[model samples]
Target: MSANIEKLQQVISSYFGTSEPIDESTVAADIDGWDSLAHASLMIRVEEEFDVQFPMEAIWKLKNVGEMASLIAKLREGA
Candidate 1:
């Protein structure tokens, strides 16, 4: 797993109390508590953990953990 994925898994585990291992393919629909109500809050926490704000369009584009990690890497690279 990449460092970004590890950190993101930690964030998801912390915020959602998910004990199972999460990987690149994990998505919101795969989690028990990651419903629409919690989506925004989870994103906020993820952004806070990475210390990077996601663009509005990029938010919609993130389909899984890998994509999110990729976007984070790309955004950080541009910084």
Candidate 2:
């Protein structure tokens, strides 16, 4: 995995208090604190961590880690 991917998973796991590995296909519903409110918080955390902001519309569409990574990559590149 890329360092960025590893760091992303680490941040997510830490937020959820889970040691289980997270992958591209991991769904948000499968993790604790991944509900609507936490989802928003997660997006904010990601933006802060990656130093990039995402569109609110796009944030609502991120259903899995892969989508989130792709969005994050796009935002980072745009930045």
Candidate 3:
């Protein structure tokens, strides 16, 4: 896996307190304790970790772990 994806998995695991490994196909809806509140918290954590800010309009468009990782990578590249 790419470093970004690995870091994203770590963030997701830490934020959601999941012992299982997260992959690109992992969906927020499928994870335990991944409700709206947790999703917000996870997003904040990801932004902080990557030092990239996601626009509000784009936040809600994220569907799965792969999408989140891709966005992070794109932001980092543009930075």
**What count of clashes does model 1 give?**
0
Judged by whole-model lDDT over C-alpha atoms, candidate 3 comes out at 0.87
Q: Model 3: runs farther than 4 Å from truth?
A: none
TM-score of each: 0.92, 0.89, 0.92
| lDDT per model vs. reference | 0.88, 0.83, 0.87
- Give the CA lDDT, 0 to 100, for residue 43 in model 2: 77
Instruction: Write candidate 1's Cα lDDT for 1-79 as tens digits.
Output: 8999999999998898979779999988888898877888888998888889999888876898899999998988987
| Tens-place lDDT digits, model 3, residues 1-79 | 8898899888888887788868898887778999887788788989999999998988888888898889988998999
* Model 2 CA deviation exceeding 4 Å by range: none
Q: CA lDDT of 36 in candidate 1?
A: 71
Model 1 scores worst on lDDT over the 10 consecutive residues at 56-65
